[model samples]
Target: MSFNSPLRDEELISKQVFERMVDIVGTSHIVANRREIMSMTEVLNRSAIKYDVPFRIATSGSMGEGFRFEESDMDVMEYPDGFQVIWDHSQNQHKSFSEGEIFVFDGSHSPPGYGLLQILSPEELNSSKLLFVKYGNSYLSSTFWKKTFLNPILGSRIHGPCISSNLECLDFDYAECLISRCWPPMASTFLSRCQLWPNPQTLQDIVNKECHLVPIGHKLGNHEEEEWMISFSLAEKALVYSMNHSQFLLYGLMKLFLKEIINKGLDEEEEILCSYHIKTAIFWTLQQGSSLECCQRNFLKCFWVCFELVTKWVYEGVCPNFFIPENNMFLTKCHGSAQRKLFCRLNAIYDVGPTCILNWLSMQDRSPSLYSYLRGNTNDLYIKELYNELAVFALPRYLNFQTCVRMLKSIVKSAPSNRDGISALVARMTYVSMLQHVAFQLMSLKKEDYTRDNNFDELSCLAIMQTAKLGSVSDLILRAMYSYRVKKYPEALFILKMAKVWLKQPYMIHFGYLDTEYSSEIAACPGNSLLEVVIKSFVFSIKLENPIFYIDELFTEQEHSRKNHWSTIFIPPFVLLLMLEFLCYRHVDTQRAQHALDELFDLMHSNQDSYLTSVFQDISWQILGICQEMAGNLQIALYAYMKSLVEPIVNRIRSATLQRIQSVKRRMCRI
Candidate 1:
């Protein structure tokens, strides 16, 4: 029994004989379900016709339960113009396979085009040229050509030819013809032209269409006993491209798709799709624990570019139909083109690396020392002026204050500079200050009326409190101005408390290393630090229903008697000031056994501190004015206080004011 079976001879025939059959029929007569594969087969058939290779198309099917296709047993006629297919039949078969003219017409097919092929020598095909491998075909090898050509195009293209299916069997010369022509033939070319319709607009579309979601079978004829067998491998390498349950691969492909979209310019709808895919890719990458640096970098780049483009559109007054409130101002007409122009000018700034931008805006610029960037030259006042200047543009949008606050804070944190630095900065903002000279300009825009908006008042108060931490002269001035604006006595008294804190605690004063921690003997004593006075003022301004508790831990642990007499003087004056200020404000509920002023008056007249008497008198007069609500009398009280503003021996009569004695005289006269 020869291994060279008669079935093999009947299967392939010769490439020359196949061409003669096709030449007789012409290209249009033979029908193929797929035009591209048909076109490819026709071209090979034409070549076979020219070369005189014997070939035949095999008509095959299993009549019983067993049905399979063999590689070498089946063949189809080939021609230079088109295929003249012939059918093959087995004599020993118990069951009948279909017998008819193998060239069955299908209505769907493309018009013919020129056919061409160039056969390579065995060395050429084995060398750099790619191979065309059929699973059941022994002649062909699984070489580069196979992967680059056969598998993607012809192997995937041909559907399993069923018993009654229009495409019933393989054309043997199809493989040989494809292999002989187009060395390193492009699989993409055949696959591309085989497309259903309209063609794939993008690479993603191509993958979506050609790659199968499930396993499919292929056909080749068996030589021995003229039978066919279906071959299944334990695992298929091509299954990677198949529709498997491996979601990870799909996700990877999606990311790859998004990367393609981002690199290639896309239209608006495409851009939106791109964003969705990119977002999903990000989530998938994270879920899969992929730490690819290239993936992250590309994602960031894509995100940043999209963000910038969207922002630019808004700036150009073409708001994308999306909910992006952050860009509302950019779309507003208040600044008109000015705002858009500004964005254009600042595009370079926005192009900064993500980390650098975040760090800079968040006041975390620790590199290059934040100070060096903020500190202007002896004459450079750009940053200082920025707060005031931006205040104007920001006010209309209700963002001025926040903008100013951020700018000033960042600038101050960026460098250590002083109140003069602050002043110079204001000089650059002369126009802005003029624009916002009155607080009502902005306050009028408050959602609540000024009187009804206690929250705003509280925020304003908080702003003042925080300003004391900055400790600039402008901050001090701003604090005073805000106090007058609110007309809340406790709010003003709180400033005195803050000022006391400023005098006693460590605080940064200037932009560069210009922090001050004032704790000399002057700051140590209650009188020297003026904490006693501030406390007294606070106590008088606030009407506490419960006895107010003081923190003992706040005071230094030094013995009282060991300190100076003037330090001791602070206790008496502070107590007297508290009682007198309260009496002035009508906050005191009762007269105690020991009058605060009298006790302090006795101490002052003892000459322990002569200046204390005059100070008491000034405080007394202030009490009188507060009680009377007399503007002129308040002036007189202010004069008295000013008179005793001396470094040492600051003095006057006892704590009783002339106004108090005069009030008694009036009552007595009435009696």
Candidate 2:
């Protein structure tokens, strides 16, 4: 046949066959079949148009490619309605009812007693005025009925007109057609049951067939294998059917199991197994339907299962712990479904990750599945973002300043984007700054028992302050250290005093070793000679000649050599005292200056130690004495100056004064 001829020939054959079909089965039934086909075609066409997908139709039975116009065969070239073929076969195709009759046609023939019998409901049989013909024992009703119709499926085979096969003598019915579609044991077993009938057995007889004797070995195959084949074939068919008509497959499967359950009244074990299989089917549907449909039709059943599972796990304490064995299984299934749907929606290939922060939060409000698990069901929201953001909501929560600083630092350091994450870090730092200010104000209050709980608030507040730079805290701490040197304990009191006003409680520090590394360095080098460079490098303006504040001064030459006796012990602390003094009061009033000089003298006398009185030291004392005299502590100031002049630089001091005195005397003589 030419390529185009096959098309023309198929059209010719289809027309001739359909006309013959109408003559025997009548035009009304053919029209009904046409209507059914049209409806299904429209559904397919619309879906194909919407998804922009190619369309292919396949047969639903074991007719292979189906007879020329078999139940499965459809002419789609001039589709959506009438044929344009020139040949009209309805009139001349069949000579009479018996010869060229289309009973299991497509060139296939039935035995004398068996042929195609139109299975009709009481209403259809009663209303139709179509002619009826006797074939075997069944009646082949005429096609031209008022309201009667034909269906492609009378259980299994497609019954469209002009369909036939090469087999000349086989006969069929719905059940036989159904059996023919199966392999081995099912077919033979079903046929054997029909053999027992007294009269000619038909398809209905096979459907109504029941078992009395045990199945034979060869007939059933290996029981396990048979069972496996049954389940496997069923699933294969379900998937194939699902590809074309998913809801129909679902309905069929659901109906079969439901009928089995109702008829057999499943025992406990069977009930569990049946329920489990049904549940599996539901999950399968969800997996497949995610892309095919929106699942609105599947919602009613899925919602019940989800609600039951979640509520059971949540309430009545069947599984008291948040995580339980059964609960995990259910959750896994749900999460799998969610992930599948999510993947489809994103059009992603590999398993996509979970919802983003915003999407998850939205789900919490809108999705019952999310709400049940996140809100009432389990404490674990599985949300990393919410926990990370908890610091924002937490209030009056005691967090040490060091802790606050550390947390903020970490947040800023790790953040990858210049978005919400960075903004949050900035907010934390601002809060810390506010806390520091409050802490300072509280310290300024200066209650007597500074260690009281109220005092702790101010210190606590300062502790929580977040800082991008360390310089601010460094300045405050250094000042506090000086105040401690002068016995101005209240000034240093701010360090721990502000805890009460703080948002969080303060952390306590237990003072340990008496000396630190910094202290040891200062003590080892007592004079400015050793410290000048370090001081300049650090740019800390401390003068060595200043009076010792917290430090204990010693006047012995051997003082540096002395071990840990009372006087010797004073050296390190006393030096620290002088540095503290410089730090607190770099410049002081004259009386206080003189008093500092007097304290040095007393210290020297008590120690019974004296060494080189440097010119600098003598001059420093003299200046202090003059400052005191200027302040009108004339007697004491004069005494201080006289003592200073009589010390190690005595001869120089006398000579200088005598020169000034002689100069005055000469001026008088001249007059």
Candidate 3:
């Protein structure tokens, strides 16, 4: 039988929808593999932190769920370490953290999915924080947490439960939470309905994981100021991954629907419906034994089924939170006339049916829609976005030596399952390159046998192995940097000459690689060759977190720069390749050095192809200014520094830019 056996020939539109979805979001295995890779990255970063830090920071929400919606802020939850939320007072004897402060909660007064945190620790300890109110007991007020996050430095403001910060490239919403070790009694009933859907093992895992209490009280609740709403974020993330590819795609499509269709042109406060409502509807549908109903062939039917569920909830004015059936998610918004408005809108869209999905953007104001590609020939090639997304899986994670070792083992073990997938192959090459990085870092460390040739040979072997697999450009540039560092100018120059030749290849593809001729024929191609070049020839950046490759000239004044908050720093590969070119040639030949310097300015100033400045714009500009200063172009250096300052200031080297500006001004006065 054919794969579309469940779909009828008369249902041509449904079949097209299913195939288009496959092109938009790859095969189920591919999406699941990509999700695993992303989850692995977050886990590695969390583990890489110091053991004694008081807080545990994690990415939650849509970004962590492997979904990136436009303008949707990345959600990061920072909760107290050592313990978890929805915790029963009984688990205090777990002995894991018995010596530490214990925060028992009272759910008696608050609603089913919300609780009041009672500081069971010493009275003196609770006095210091001042976040507690004497409402019969020393209960923590979520209002206090709101005030704490309101310190305006940059463009940070309170957005619901989170403190939204405008980072240069990405906007982040940080929600401070308290973890409860035990599962909430309120959600205990949700497990009983799990028999048909989650399977025994997955259900057991959900029971074992911790839940959290986000700092927002139910607005209509009596203890509005103090109540902390229970969050099943940890459990939700697990459930989302356990979903079949069809379900995941439906969820993604539902999100797009909520954003583009339901909320289109509506002010934030005016849009009563939310993604959570849609998620709860899907979760209930899955538990009610509709899991198998979701399939690639009849996904449109499945989407409609889920949509009807939401419409029913809107009309009833009682959208149940999946975990705690008593927690009416629509309590505040979907009521009376508001409910009538939402129901009418969803009903009209329901009546229109597939046009709602296919004409999502066009129906609004004739804008381009995601389904526009579906209107074209399937074999006409647009690189099928999901695999293009897979390119990032090979980039190094935020890791140290030990974590890199663990990351390496994990990547290697998962290799067999991925088979011929581009991401898996790139991942294999990534682990080898990770070893090369470790060896390179070993060169910078002090060793008693510094004179021994063993370390050097081992390092050289790994470098050559990487060179053989993914071109010799990055490793060659790294070698030249080291050679120039130890005063081997002629050797460095020769290595760079080889690197320059390798660099001349047409730029390798990464995210946002193709220009706006995006729909034109130029963007239509790059399928197999794109994968081949990215795998075997592209210059993959050695993330600073990995510490594989280094040059002294790359750093700003270390002591003055507060780079700790920066999760990872991206200095584009081209900046390193050409910057070292300038340094190496300056020692050997003035004419060549001048030529390299000219190239540096061009790369920095030009917003052209061949180099991606979008990700590391500020850092690249800063590097150019540093090189200009070295060349005694003080005025031009100041101009370049100012350009770096103009970009977003969140993770960039702003202090270094400011200090350098002062240093240049002082030097100019001395002249």
TM-score of 3: 0.77
lDDT of 3 by residue, 1-671 (tens): 12334443535655556655564455565565556656655554454443535778766677566664565556778876744443666666653663445677788887778878887754645445545666667766687866764454455777778878855356778888877667777788978867887778888898888777888888888888778888888888888888877788788777777887887888888888888887888888888876447776677778778888888988999988888999998888889887898888988998987646766652234323334544753321333344334445445443565555556566656554544555455555556556655655555666775676566646644554454455435656656666676677887778777777776644333333533333343333456444453453445553454234356665553322335345445666678777888887887888888899899898777876456456566777887888889999999989988988898653457888898899889988999
Candidate 3, position 161, lDDT: 82
Q: Candidates 1 and 2: which is better by TM-score?
A: 1
In each prediction, how many residue pairs overlap at the backbone (N, C-alpha, C within less than 3 A)? 42, 35, 6
Q: In lDDT terms, which candidate is top?
A: 3
Report the C-alpha lDDT of model 2 over 43-93, residue by residue, as the tens digit.
323322322223222222211111112222222111111101111134224
Per-candidate local distance difference test: 0.28, 0.29, 0.67
C-alpha-based local distance difference test score of model 2: 0.29
Worst 10 residues of 1 by lDDT: 540-549
For all predicted structures, in order, the TM-scores are: 0.18, 0.15, 0.77
Residue 81 in candidate 1, Cα distance off native in Å: 97
Q: Write the residue-wise lDDT of candidate 1 on 1-671 in tens digits.
A: 11233443321322222222222211221111112222222232232233232432211111110111122122221212221111111221332323321221111111111111112222433344332222322222212322333332322343321111111122222222211111111223333442332223432343332111011111111211111111111011111112212222223333333334222354443233333223223332332333323222243343344344444543554432111112222222314555455445435445653222222211221223222323422211221222212221111111234333443343344332432332223222221221222232334345755566355645544544554443333333334434534454455445534543442233211111112232122222444222221211111111010111111210121122112111111212232333332332322222421243344334333553312323334333333333332222334434433333322331222232343345545544666
Better of 2 and 3 by TM-score: 3
Model 2 residue 408 lDDT?
38
